[model samples]
Target chain A: MTDTVLATQAVREESPPRRGGGRNPLRHALLIALGVVMIYPLLWMLSSSVKPTEIIFRDPSLWPSSFDLGNYVEGWTALGAPFHQYLLNSAIIAVGCIVGNLLSCSLAAYAFARLEFRGRKLMFAAMLVTIMLPIHVLIVPQYVLFSQLDWINTFLPLIVPKFLATDAFFIFLMVQFIRTLPIELDEAARIDGCGHFRIYWRIIMPLCTPALATTAVFTFIWSWNDFFSQLIFLTDQDLYTVPVALRSFVDGQGATSWGPLFAMSIVGLAPIFGFFLAGQRYLTQGIATTGIK
Target chain B: MTEPDRSAPPGGALSLASPPTAPAPAAEAPPAARRRRGRRSQRAVRDGRVAYLFLAPWIVGMVVVTIWPIAASLYLSFTDYSLLRAPRWVGLDNFAEMLGDERLVSALGVTFTYVVVSVPLQLALALALAMLLDRGVRGLPFYRSVYYLPSLLAGSVSIAILWRQMFGTDGLFNDFLALFGVQGIGWVSHPDFALGTLVVLNVWTFGAPMVIFLAGLRQIPVMYYEAATVDGAGRWARFRHITIPLLTPIIFFNLVLQTIGAFQTFTQAFVVSGGTGGPSDATLFYTLYLYERGFGSFDMGYASALAWLLLVIVAALTGLNFLLAKRWVFYGD
Candidate 1:
């Protein structure tokens, strides 16, 4: 859902030019300047994280003269619970979401795309409309529901809906991907005495690697970065995800720990950065195709 | 009801992969086997049952998590529910109260301003960058990837903290401004500039739309540019006549999507304003206000009303975008 490239056909022929030419240097120079401006904050964060707390404001230079590792050590235990615990919590949520979304969404997508069922079209349409229903509308009622179920302060509120395939976006993405696949494979399998479930598991699922990868990457990132839900539900300090834990450092206290906060901030962003770097292609590809199709 | 066809379509690859759970076919049965196997009457019912089985999780979730909450919230909007007490019916009271609530009014104003200022700016920047990148730049994907990084970090608490620090009175922005002998205000704490800083933040994440714009730009046939050049059309003419017209659909799409997103913006304002949506509620986004009412003050009923109000606004805006798009958005079909 990130971007929709309305006409992918237009740019397919033009490979990125390898050799530089007239005016290219100026274009490169302009791009370089913009890139520096864009990336400076991240560099500044990295610089500030290593700088001594006293010099952080005074030394505005991105390349800090002094390197202090104390911030990293201090930030770990800054919020009573160790930073590793928060990372572990985020990891658990992300992993749960990935597994749940992959399994449930793909199952539902298969039904919508391949299987003929009563109310299939109607159900699919209903799911599409839900995409427009803002998360704001659900926040209050969901909070109340979770509280009433006595599931507050636990991962259940965060993780349970994922297992139920509540994310229609991914389901729609997988359905689109599944439809593009050859139906002849299913027919051949059926003739060979393969049942629907067997065909789904062996034939369809195997062929949907790209779509599944996109779903997994997005689910992991979104779940890991989900602050609002985790913040509301997991009131316990120990159960806080990375984003929630990061918020505690900047809770408008009298004496804010800027150094450790910046340090932990870098640490918290590391996984997402790493994930993006690893799955950058798939992430953009997913976003590009998911909505447009 | 459609039946599952047993035969493959013409020109299909007949090479079948090994199926994990394949059942043994009846070797001796012929016409009876065909009758049993070709039971097209049962196929529709069987497929329907299996489809539901596969869709079970989503069906349950739709009812339990999504539908129920939406219905409950709609009901709660007309009630007086706090977390502690059972909801009492109060028809139109909550909505009526919103008419006079100064903070809620300001919150809506702040949110509308944020969306108005940010979405277009972000999309403009995105389209600009995309046009530049579409010029057969070397390592285009690499540059695209780098630009997209900011969007990945956008709306994170860490980024908000970093933003506040960067824009503080004695922060990096001020220090940078010192080189030009200009004094900078504490952008986050200053009411006049707090919303501006958040707007800057929203604009910084233009990478998402930029990539999409790049795709849209790519969709514009190079032949159009070539033809324009043959007619002695300059760069600006070609862009105005060809690119803009062709890219309108994407522009419209991004506008609608980004508007909805900007309207829902909460984390940036929340974290920047220290979760108070202040320096005098200057940065109190509608979502943040709803959150504060629902969680901070435990006024669930009013919050639900506010939430529904947001949904209505977004839906109306989206609907309007579609109606307006008819005048401008050109599909190449």
Candidate 2:
């Protein structure tokens, strides 16, 4: 049945290409053309990062004239601290958010999906409203609250919220996923003397690997790429995440370091690009099934 | 809060089609229907206890992390509070000031223009590509991954940075135009074209909505298309008659979600315009303006008021879409 999911992710299913109009070659030609337009900017950046600074714009060819490795080396230390410091900061936050979303969102999802507790429907509706609420409305007061707590310039303001399943989107995703599992498994577990916690922890969670992976992957990407909150919170240079550090380069040392900036831009995008190559299935199916970006 | 452009929102919109608002996702429903064995007081009590135990962190988080901030923001919007000062009661002053604020009005105009222009273009591209690819292309996954790559990273600082360079005076765009002996202005720095570049950037990442459209298209039984063709319907006729009506829900869904996402754009404008929304504020997105007010100047009260304005605008627009959706969004029984 889950193979139906594989089908929807668009490539894994072995469904035959629709047979019609005898226009297969034309379709293939158009796709290749569009694909090149889609990927050109990225390829340009990748090549420009390795090109000599003076020739970056002059040589518009995607293949660089000279494969200079200086940009990567220079950009590494160009931001005052080494680039790895920023990456490490981002990694710490992403790991914290992933573990937080997995643990908190799953528990909430289970309650919403299977348990018939009092106020479950009401709580679920309230959670949905949270999803619809724009973060702009909350950021000011949240900044105020964090400042009052003296949590600004620390990852506490960023990492701590996820521990509470504040990301209702993941909870909503997991609830939809958990509802698909056969209830007979829970019924049988109940008959065998398993309680709700046991059924949730042992039975349901093991079956939710796909949903968990979805939450984890998205948490990492969003946290790693997140700018607004991070920009506001991490003003101290030492606490800068990748996004903040990248912006600083644009602000302070932009003109002389075009090549280095592109290098760092490539560096910032690599983990996610590599992540896409690795977890393409999870990323696409996550969107395809959830009808989300 | 998760970034606006990625996956945080729109996913919420999908839940509108799911439980609490509609029937359960039709798996194991019969057993759930038959289970009158539930609702016994002892079982109910035990279930509630266990469920709350599992839900402890989420419940606490919801109140402290989400609800508290929302309530505080609403309250803050009504006061003259700056950081390090007591929040002075100034009911309606902040709202009153917004009317006379030129930057606020410019921000509103810029945001509305962005939402109005970029969304339809993006969704139209998405629907067009989805239709083209849904016709069974070879390497569908490869095409999808290549296309979807930008949507995933478009919200990042790197992409925004690249966008700035791509339109800079000596950037690749001008270089491309140079080949035709046509003079290319610095698009990123040009007030006339700064927001246009951003609009083009939004339209470029049509892959996300396209993927959703593909999934929705798959849900349409091939037999319908087959029958239509057998009855002598042409390709355009089949799409107009069959595909259009059936695809309306997905179209409306993308419209609302994308509109909301576009309105919240900050990183692109912040980066492309060098945190000034400059070239004379042509690309000053509303969120960018809000960030400038709240963080740049530390005007928490006015910023909070601006935040509420954004929330209401989004909510009203979403409400309006649902109302308009009834006129056109179709559901097949």
Candidate 3:
């Protein structure tokens, strides 16, 4: 009897029918139409990247009169700074940020989550307050500081602070994930004569792989897409990231190459999309838990 | 170091309590057992030092990078500190100038309008899509991945480039419209429509919020819906009474985050306006204006002031959100 009631509850929850079956089909059709509308620009961009300049403006709807791979080749060479150099620069900064964040954030998160220390709650709240502080406010002084240290035009300004527990959002995320772990594991490790650091490394770090992966993926994406910072710091053409390099393709004067610019953009986004597809499960679950909390 | 005599009278008496156990002979006793144990305890104390040792790199980075830069920025906002020379003391000049600047006023207006319009529209679209996907739909994961693809590529330089094309005069949007005998205007170049194109782009990447909404919807008890259904509540009535109220907190979360994000929008404006805030500076956002002043005009002092003003505006908006959430957000607990 209870089973039947529970089954009915599930069915009703899944499908709560309203008035007019006639209206249902209309709503469904409208949703599909909206989805296509949302995706159309992306499809159009993909289609435009392969078309020749004539067809680009003339026959915009044609998939391509012929497959022209020249656009990618020309775009890559026309970057002034080699396209591979920009990709290399982006990779170095992103990887450095990921490594830094993983080590520092996880440690800070473990302390905040499990350790009983003086001023722990206060420190955590201070970290949270930093999130509200806009990055724009700090840019001028940060530039001055880097200039003084002779660090301008280098990746250090972009890559080094991340080694600190600077991004409080990710730290808070790690803290919450650590809190959900069973405390009995810590107690058992302690009983076996394991110290706090040992317990964290041997037990907690291993279990927190999914959270770490999420943080790494997000940091990689953010670092890769960072435009303003790269523009400000790296003035030398050789040190430019992909975004800055792509911007250089458009002369400030009248000349603008739509075909090559679009082509480079497609190439630039390939790695990020690939990364997202590979680790999307962890990313979704991480975001869900983070938002719900 | 003399060891404790295990065969002594008290040791023998202690062992006698357990008949199966016998005290070790004194001749076989180690000479420094107590000393060794004392040394081992000291070693354990030394081993406890590793925690701070492992954390030293982060502490150094915090002091030199994060903490110092923030302190310097706060101090620099008070002084005339262009990059070429040493900063000179100037009290409140930057802030006072900002109050009278018409460009700053218009930039703030544009930014607030962008935030106010884009955030709610984005969240509403996200919630609607999430609800559609929550119905045990077939190919749920595939639909989700497709919907989420835009967000993954949302803030890239490429998306901005793509947006420029899609909204251009002779671009695909115009072509699509021409089929219906409707002529299209230059969406990116026209001052009236440039900001609107950005808002549409902001709204298009509603995947992150939608995913969050989907998770929140999943947590609402199925029994509540069943009870409402059994009471003969219609679909619209059930959603209005139960879904919206229960989902308010998550909606509030998305509002605060998206508003902050929208205010910091720089990429689309930078790329679309070709980094010049073209056609009478209509696409000049707060951050874009900041970039122009600091980098374009080389006025670091005024830009620093602008940055602080942005910080204050964001803080005020967030504070307002927290104040209002109490009245609307329904916590299940």
Candidate 4:
């Protein structure tokens, strides 16, 4: 079955030369130019973050005339809430989301993949339909619900539902991954007098490390970058995430300090870049697998 | 969670009929042990109750958290519920008010226009890039990752901040325009160009669809192209006859997904317009309007109504696309 699937994929790989018939050198140059255009803004931001405030707008090029690392220190201290506290809040929320998503999603995925139950197909379909539901529809009601429970301004709004499998997309992804594993291992564990929970904890979880890693990376990035929910739920400046705190750099009176804002922006995005680099291998594999399916 | 018995009444008959295939070890085992095993299997089937036990939290969560909130929002849309007071039964008053509300009408208009214009342009750009990367080019993976980097950072607040700098007065975009002997209009500051800047931002994140398109492009059979080439078809002709037809389904998929996404856009406009949807509310997208009503003004009832309207609009558009796709989206059956 696997070979057949691979063969079909191979057959599908053989198209798309008609539009790529231009001169190779010109095409390569154009592609590189496009990449540079796309990447230059980021490079500019990184360079400007280190430049002194007076020279930021003065230099229009990709590189700064001189590097002044004081911008980082100044920006960090000048933020309304200490940058470190916001960073800590972001880290806690992100890590909590990751842990909650993995445990709840993997358990649900395993059950959906391996167990037989009534209404399984209907329940699965309902889960998929939720993906189509626009999130804006849920915000007000969710806010009201959280407020009634007195969970406002607390991490409960962000981290609690994840532990209960609130997001079904990750669970579906885990289900698809778990379904590809062989069933014989489960049967063998059963014959040895093990139960379903034991099989899940001892055998299934260990084997699905790659999927779990992918889930963790994605959940971390998403929760870290989440601004809308953070903006709504956290009113206190001390409770802000990095993204929320960064917005305060732009004065509502139309005066934005480009140097300090960009500096803080770079600092904010550093962890995401670090995380992506650290998990590059697993991320690519996960993208290739989940995307194709 | 239940296991099927392999040596009960039906199993015994099957075992007797297929005795040759039945394991000799099972036959040598005492009848009492075999019966015990059968009973154990039956018990496993009957008492496989832990499956639901494992799923209990998620089930309760779906009910209390997701389902209840959705139902509450649906009911709230028909009432007048400002955050300050108890909800009053207004009975379609919010919807009626929305119809006559000029700001809401224009927000929907602006949102529809953004979705209609951006989705196709983005997909076309993505497909073109995907085709360029599919030529077995060296450093293919690196280029793919570079292109995909924008998507990873696309929706973040930092990118929105970066967008303001790029399109603001005296920004890089205007500086580039200067070299071409053309003056830059206020891209993000002027009401006329504010929405255009947003469209550009939406177009910039074509990387995700481009990756999907690359995967889809790889799936096409090379023999079909060879056959077309042998028939003396030129590059353009081959593309017209073969590539375009095969790529329709993916295009349709991207179109639907991107449309749904674009209609719900909030952050870029919120950040660019300074969270006020200003420059005469030209950049007031649907969700941003919803945010203004629900959060900024605390008009929960009206916002709920608008939210339901957006859900309907998205679902209707997606449904319409699928219905039309029957005619255009070719399957490889």
Per-residue lDDT, model 4, residue B29, is 67
Q: Which candidate leads in TM-score?
A: 2
Model 1 residue B273 CA deviation (Å) reads: 0.7
On the 0 to 100 scale, the lDDT of residue A107 in model 1 is 92
Top candidate on lDDT is 2
Q: What is the DockQ of each candidate?
A: 0.40, 0.47, 0.27, 0.36
Q: lDDT for model 4, on a 0 to 1 scale? A: 0.77
Write the residue-wise lDDT of candidate 1 on B1-333 in tens digits. 122222211112222211121222434559776576556425755776787789889989998999899889999999999989899999999999999999998998999899998889999898888877786687677788888889888868889889988898878899999989998888889989999999999999999888778777766657788888999999899889999998888898788778877888888888888789999999999989999999999999999999888878888999999999899988766
Considering only N, C-alpha and C atoms within 3 Å, which residue pairs clash in candidate 2? none
Per-residue accuracy of model 1 over A1-293 as CA lDDT, tens digit each: 22242332233345533323425888878877888999998999999999888889888788889888999998888886899999999999899889999999999999989986545556777887776677888999999999999999999888889889998888888877787788999999999999989999999999999888888878877887778888899888889899998888778342357888899989988888988988886777666554321
Ordering by DockQ: 2, 1, 4, 3
Q: Which 10-residue window in model 1 chain A sums to the lowest lDDT?
A: A1-10
Q: Which 10-residue span in candidate 3 chain B carries the lowest summed lDDT? A: B12-21
Query: For this target, which candidate reaches the highest DockQ against the unseen true structure?
Result: 2
Scored on chain A only, each candidate's TM-score is: 0.91, 0.93, 0.88, 0.89
Query: Against the hidden reference, what TM-scores do the models get?
Result: 0.90, 0.92, 0.86, 0.88
Query: Which candidate would rank higher by TM-score, 3 or 4?
Result: 4
What lDDT tens digits, residue by residue, belong to model 2 across residues A1-293?
Answer: 13224334443345555666435898778888988988899999999999978888889898787898999999999977999999999999999999999999999999888875556667777787777777787899999889989999999999999999999888887887898799999999999999888999999999999889878888889999999999999989999999999999988886667899999999999998887787777777777665556
Residue pair clashes in candidate 3: none
Comparison by lDDT, 2 against 3, better one: 2
Candidate 4: residue B218 lDDT (0-100): 75
Q: Please give me the total number of clashing residue pairs in predicted model 3.
A: 0
Candidate 4's interface RMSD, please? Answer: 7.5
lDDT of 3 by residue, B1-333 (tens): 123322223222122112322344434547686556446435433432443444455556556666776677667778887788888779998888888998887798788888988988988999988888775565557667777778777788788877877788877788889989999998888988888899999988898888778777776777898899999999899999999998887788778778888888998789878897665777889999999998888788788788877878888999999999899988766
